[model samples]
Target chain A: MLMEKSAVENGFIIDLSSIKNTSQLVFELSSIMEHPDVKGKNICLKLGSLDLKQSQLLSIKALIESMNAKIAFIDTKSEQTEASAVSLGIMIKEISSDLTADIAPSEEDFKDSEYKEEAVEERTENPVQDTNSQEIVEVHTEVHNNPIETTEGIEDIYDEVSAQELSEVIPSENYQPDGFGILAASEGLLPEETSKYILLDTGNVLPEGVEENSVNTESMQTLYINQTLRSGQTISYDGNVFIIGDAHPGSEIIAGGDITVWGILGGIAHAGCNGNITSKVRALKLNAIQLRIAGLYARRNDTLNVPYVQKTNEFTPEEALIEDGKIVIYKKLRRD
Target chain B: MTGRVIVITSGKGGVGKTTTSANIGTALAKSGYKVVLIDTDLGLRNLDLLLGLENRIVYTIVDVIEERCKLRQALVKDKKNPNLQLLAAAQTRDKTAVNAEQLKEICDTLKEENDFVLVDCPAGIEQGFQNAVAGASEAIVVTTPEMSAIRDADRIIGLLATKEEITSVKLLLNRVRPNLIKSNEMMSVDDVVGILEIPLVGIIPEDAGIITSTNKGEPIVNDENALAGKAYRNVAERILGEEVPFLDLDEPKGFMAKIKNAIAKLKVKV
Candidate 1:
C-alpha cells in the first residue's frame, strides 16, 4: 500500500520506503529484479528513512547487478543511508515531497499503485506489476521470542518438565581459586542475551580489498548433505549449504550464501561468508557455539556452556540474521 | 600410514595423568598396536619409570631433538613387549630445552613408524604442555573427581579448543571411588560429565595396585587380575572405535569378595 508505479517509457523505480531492516529491503528488491522484463534495465531505488552502513548499501547494489540489472541512482530520507550511498559512490537524487503531486505521467507505459518512485517511486505508486510478474519474497518479523539458546529435551528424560524452558541461563562453573587457582567458582544466575554472547571485537573481519555484496541467495547452487559434522571437520562451500543432520560442537560450517540445518546446530556457522548482507542461518534447534553472519562474529556466552541438551523429536525452529550492525536471532519463523 | 598422535594432559599435578598414559599405552600395545609413549614432562619425566624401562634407556628425547642421537637410538624398547617403546624425557634439562616445533618434528618422525604416539604431558599448561600438544591431533584430558582436578580439567579443555589441529578432546576420569560416591562424599561420574561437557573415554577406579605398579616400574594394565587393568584395556578398545559398557564400580565379583562384602555390610549394620 505504501507503493505506487507508473511505468514511464524508460527504466523503472523501486520504492522500498516501508521496509524496516536492510535485509528485508534487499530481499524484497532481489525478488522483484528476478522478473524477466526487469533484466538489463537500469533501476532507481527509493530507500526510506532506514540507517544503512556502507557495507549494506554496497550489498544492495551488488544484488541488483547479480540479476543482470543495475541501479542508476537511489533517493534516501535518512542521513545515515544517504551517507552510506555517498561513501559507496552511489548517486543520490532527492525526490522532494512537494514535487510528487506536480509530476504526472500523461502517457502510461506501465501503471499501478497510489504513487511510486520519484519518476520512479512515482512509478511504484502506480504498480502495474500485477499484470507482469512481481513476486517479492516477504520476510515477516515475529516480535515475541523465547530464551536465546532454548533446547527441548527435559521432557524426554526428566518427564516432569513438559514445556520448553525459557532461555535457560547457565552459570560459569569457573573461578580463579587463588593467584593461580581454578576448578571452582560461585555459580550466579544472570539475565540472558547480554550474557550469552560477547561480540568478538575483531574489526572488519571481511578480507582486505573485499566489499560486501548480496548475490541473490536463491540463484546460488545449494550443497546438500546428510551427516553429523564432528569436531575438526569443516565444511566450507562457495554457495548455500543445507545440512540434514546435527553440527556438533567444535565443528565449523562456512558458506557464501545461507546456511540451513535440519537438526540441532551446535557448532560454529558462518553464513554469507563472502559478505552478502541478506544471507541467513536457520536451524531446527539453534544452540550454536558461535554464530557468524556476513562481517559480524558472536561467541556463545561462556555462562551458557551448560549444554544439557538431548536430541529429541520436538524442535523450536530458530533463525539468525544481521540487523542494526549486530546478529539478531528470531525465535519463530513467520510466513505470510 | 600416518599414525595418530594423542596427548594425555592434566593441568593439576598428581591427577593420575602419568599413570593413565602408562596403562593406556601398555593396553594398546597388548592389543597388538605398535605404540610409542613420549614422556614430554621433560625435567620431571616419569613414563619410563612407570613402564619399568628407565634403566634400559640409552638416549632420551632431548638427545634426538638436539641431533646427538637418531630417533631409533633414543626409542627405548620395553623389556617385555617389543611392540611398546618409550622416548624418555631428559631429567637434566628443563622444559625450556625443547621447543614446540622440535617436539612436533620428533612426533612426526616417530608417528611415521609407529601406530600410536601417546604424549605424556607435563603437570601444568606451560612450555612442556605446549610442546606436548603441538604434536598431537587428538587429546585425552585426565582428571580426578576432586573439585580442584575437575576445575583444572575444565581450563585445560578450554585451552585444547583453541588449537585448530587437535580435533577430538575426550575426558578420562581417574581415581573414581565408588564407595565414596555412594556415601555422597565424592562427585559421581554423571556430575563430572555434566560439568565437563565432553564425551567420556574411560573411568579408572582407585586401586591400591596402581601404587605398587608405579613403585615396581610396571603399568597396572599388565596385571590381569586388576580392575584398573581391565578398565585401561577397555579404554584402548574404545579408542579403536569399539563400544564398551563402563565398569560398574559397585559390583565386586567372585565368591571370596562377595562373602567379604556381605560380612562387611552385616558388621556395618550391627
Candidate 2:
C-alpha cells in the first residue's frame, strides 16, 4: 500500500516512507495532487529516509508545478537541495517553528529578499522577451548570488555591514573603529598602572631630551679609527666613536654618543653632546686632560683621586659617566 | 736611471736628521750608486759639515734656485767618495730663499742624472720643511727615543700621510740606549714605533763614537768598525730592497758579563 498522506496548513503532506527515487517521489506527489481535495493546492513532501540530489528535487518541483499545484520539501537538512528548490521557485518548510522564528531577517537576509524582488520584477516586466535578454537576466541573477558561493564572500558582507554601522554608531571624530583605531584605543583603555608597567618594560621612556635623542640615535653613525690620533688631530662625529690606538695629549674627540678607545686616551674627550647624560667615555687608559659628558665637565685634577690601580701604577682601564650632575671616573669592571 | 727622491726629516731639532741623511747617502755611494745630498735647511745647513764637504761649497741650493748657477755647478763633489755629492744650503739666505716648487724642479732635474737624491729637511714644520718634503716621493722620519721627539715625529707622520706623492714613510729611531730602555727610564724602539705607527727602517744605538765622528767632520758610516756605522749600512741596504736584521743592542756586553760573573761568585759565597 502507498504511504499515508496528512494535511497541513494550506498544503497536503505526502510522506516518503516507501519512496526510494525521484521517479517514485514524483509518482506519489502526482497521485496526491490528482486527488480532488488536494488539486491546485500546495504540497509538502515529507522525507523519511530518502536523500535526493538537486536535479531530482528540481524535476519533482517542475512536475508538481505542471499539475497547477505548488510544491515544497519538508525536513530538508541539505543546503544543495534547498538551493535547487529555491532556484526552481519551490518553497522550503523548516522542520521546527522555533528555529524558523529564531532566524529573523538579518542584513544579508534583507539584501537577498530585495534581490529576489528585483529579479521577480524584471522577470514579470520582460516576459516573452528575446533569448538574449533572458540570458542577460540570468547573468545578472548569477552575479547577485555570486557571493553565496564562497566563505570569504560572507566575511566581505559582514565587514561592509560592520564598517557602515561603525560610521553611524560612533559620532565622535576622534573615535575611529578600524583595526588600527581599535588597537590605538586599546592602549588608552588600559589602566594607569598597567600602562606604566608596559612603559617600564619597554625601557624607551628617556628623559627631557627625547626629541634630540631620537634624532641623534636614528641618523647617528660610528667612526672607527685603526691608527693613533696624534696631537693636533681632532675628530668630531655625530654618533658613537671608537679608536683602536692611542690619543696623544693635544688630540681631541667629540661625539654625540659614547666614545671608546682601545688604547691610551690622554687628550680631550667630549661625548653626549646631544644632552644624553647616560652616554659614557671608556678607554684603556683614561687620562684625559678634560672629559665632557653633556654639559658637565671634569678636569684632570678633579679625577686625580679616582683610583685606577691596575698592575701597580700602570694605566688601568677606566670609564667616565655623568652621575648626579657631575662627571665621575671609575675603574671599569672586567665584564664592561 | 730615474732616482728616488727621499726626504730625511725630524720634526724636532737635533734629532740627527742631517746625520742620518749624510750617512745613508754615503752608504749608498759606497755601494756604487750616485747619490746627492741636498741641504734644504737654507740658512742653517749642517749636512755639509756632517759630510766633511763644508769648505768646498762655492754655490748653495739657494744660488741654484735663484738661477745664479746651474744645478750641476752647485753640486759639490765628495773628496772621499767620487760618486757622492753635496748641495749645501746658503748660510745668509732664509728658508724663503727657495719655495717648494723650485726645490721640486731642482730635484726633478737632479734625479735624471743621479740614482738617489736625499734631501736633508730643516727642523720645524715651516716653509723649510715644506720645501724639503715637496720634492720627495718617499720620506724617512728620524726620531730620538725621547718623548718630545716622538711627539714631533708623530705630528710629521700625520702631515706626511696627507701628501699625495709620498708613497712610503719609514721611521729611524736614533740614539736608543739599551741599558736605559731596560731600566724603563728611556723609551724603547718599540715604544716609539708604537706611537709613530710607522715601519721601522733602522735603530741606531747610543754610541760615543758618533760624537767624535761628527766633530771630525766625517760621517760615521765611513767607520766600518763603529756600531752606528753598521746600523746605517743596514738601513741603506734595506732601503735598496735588501733584508738585513737589526743589530742586537741589548746583547750581553763585557760590563754586563762582568757583573753577571760577580753575581755568580757572590751567590757561591752565600
Candidate 3:
C-alpha cells in the first residue's frame, strides 16, 4: 500500500562570487526547501566564497525554521588561522579523550586487563552473556549494512492501515496531487485555466435555455468589493463583485459570476467571462465602455461603423444578449 | 400635479449656491409661480436669513418631519411675496437628523402642492448634499469664474451624471464682473462653460446690489429695477420654457446718467 516515495536530496555548491541576483536565488532555494515530500528532512546548505547580505542571511534562516530541519552552512573563504581557531574548539570537545587514551597506554592497559578478567568470570557463571553477545553482533552488522531498513519495515505496516482509514474518511473527488496549490492573480491578470457550466444541461444538442453571452447565474459566486475603484483600474474575479460604491469609467470588470454595484457603475463589466452565459451585471446606474458575456461582445463605441455618432448622453442602462449569432442590446423590463 | 424638484449645488463652498437659489426662487415667485424654497443646510441654515424670512419661521422642516407640526404649519410665508414660501432648516440639529429617503418623502408631499421645489443644497458632496438631491429630477450647478470653483463644478456634474439619468443639467455662472472679463483678468462665461463642458443656463454680472441685499436679508430679485435681478428673472423664465433675450455683456454700456450713477455707487462700495 505504500507508494514509492521519490526522496531526492541533492546538494548544490553555489558560488556566491558568480551569482548576481542573490535575493532571487534565495527565494528559489526557499521554495526548494518547501517542496512537499522532502520538506521535513534535515537540510544542510553550505555557503561558500562570499559575504551574504543581512537580508539574504535572515531569509535563509527563516526558510530553515519553516521546514523544521537542521542547516549547517560551511564558510570556506575565511582566513586559515581563523578557520583553525574554530576547529580548535571542535577538537578540544571531541578529540581530547580519544587522543589521551591512544597516548596514555600502559596505565589504561592495566585497568582494561582487570576489567576483562571480571567480564570473563561473569560470562562463565551467567548464560545471559551468551545471548547478549549474539544480539550485539547482529545489531552491529545491521548498522554497517542498512540502518534505515528496520524503520522502513515498521512504516509499511502504518501506511496500509492509515490508507484504509483515510479512504473511508475523504471523498474521492477531494483527492489531488500533493503539490497542488492555489494560484493568486492580480488585477487584469487572467487565470491559467477557466471553468464553465451551462444553465440547463439537457441531453440534447441545443441548450434548453437559449440565452447566450450572459452569465450562468445559477452558479453565481459573490465577491465583496470594499474599495472605491477609480478610473483606469480593472478588476476581474471568478465570482460576482459587490461594489460598496461607484465604479468609474475607463475601468474594466470581469467576473465568472454576477456583478452587483450598490452605487453607480460607469465602467465596463463582463459577466460569465468563463462562458457561463447566465451571469448578469446589475448596478444602480450602468454607463459602461463595453459589455461582454461568453462569446458575445457589445462593441458599440468602435469607430469601424461609419457615422453612428452617438454621444455618451444617448446611452442608457440596457441588458445585452446574443441573438442569432449577433450581439444586441435590449431594454430591461421595468419592475414597476 | 406633482412639482419636479431641483437641487442647486456646487462641490466647492461659497460659490454663490444659496444666492442663486434665493434669487431664482424670488424670480419664479415674482412671475406668479408657486415656489417653495427648502434649505437643506441643516444647522447652518442661511437661506431663510438670505430670503429675509428668518423671523417668520415658526416651525422648521425638522419640526414637521419629527411630527411636531404639519408640513403646512412649518412653511414660512415670505413677508412681501405672496406666492413664495420657505421651508427653513432646523438650527438645532445636524445633517444626520434626516437622510435621503426622509428628504425624498418630504419633497414628494411638497411637490403635490407647489409648482417648483428648489432645494438649496449644502457645499460639500456628502450626506447633506445627498439629502438635498434626493427626489430631484434636475440639477443646477452654480460656480464662479475661478479655477477652484470650476473644478468643483466639474466634479459635481460628474457625480450627478453617475447617480441618475438627468435630462437637463445647466450651469449658472454667478458673481461675474464684465469689466474684468473684458480686461482678460477673469474667466468669461464661455470659458467656464467650455471647461466644465455643460450647457450654460444664465450669466449673473457682478452687482453691488447682491451684497447689499444679502446684508439686509433681501433677495436681489426684489429689486426689479436692478440689472442682476433682471438677469435672474430671465433665468427663471428660461427654466419655465419661455425664451428670453440673454444679457448683452459684450455691448458697451450706455453713457446714461442712471448707469453712471450706479457705477459710481458700485465703485464706492468696493
Which ranking of candidates, highest lDDT first? 1, 2, 3
Q: B1-270 in candidate 1: lDDT tens per residue? A: 789999999899999889999999999898899999999987677787677654345457888888876788778788678999999887656899999999999899889888999999999898989999999999999999999999999999999999999999999999888989999999999999999999999999988767656755668787777788889999999999999999988974332231122110000000
How does chain B score by TM in each prediction? 0.93, 0.92, 0.91
Model-by-model DockQ, in order: 0.01, 0.00, 0.00
Per-model TM-score on C-alpha atoms: 0.43, 0.42, 0.42
TM-score of candidate 1 versus the correct structure, residues matched by position: 0.43
lDDT of each: 0.70, 0.65, 0.59
TM-scores of chain A across the candidates, in order, are: 0.44, 0.33, 0.30
Winning model by lDDT? 1
Report the C-alpha lDDT of model 2 over B224-246, residue by residue, as the tens digit. 66778889999999999988999
TM-score of 2: 0.42
Supply the DockQ value of model 1: 0.01
For model 2, how does the per-residue alpha-carbon lDDT over A120-188 read when each residue is reduced to its tens digit?
564576475355233323332333343333222233323423331222112123232222111111123
Clashing pairs in 3: A214-A277, A214-A278, A215-A277, A215-A278, A215-A279, A216-A278, A216-A279, A217-A278
The regions of model 2 sitting more than 4 angstroms off are: A1-336, B251-270
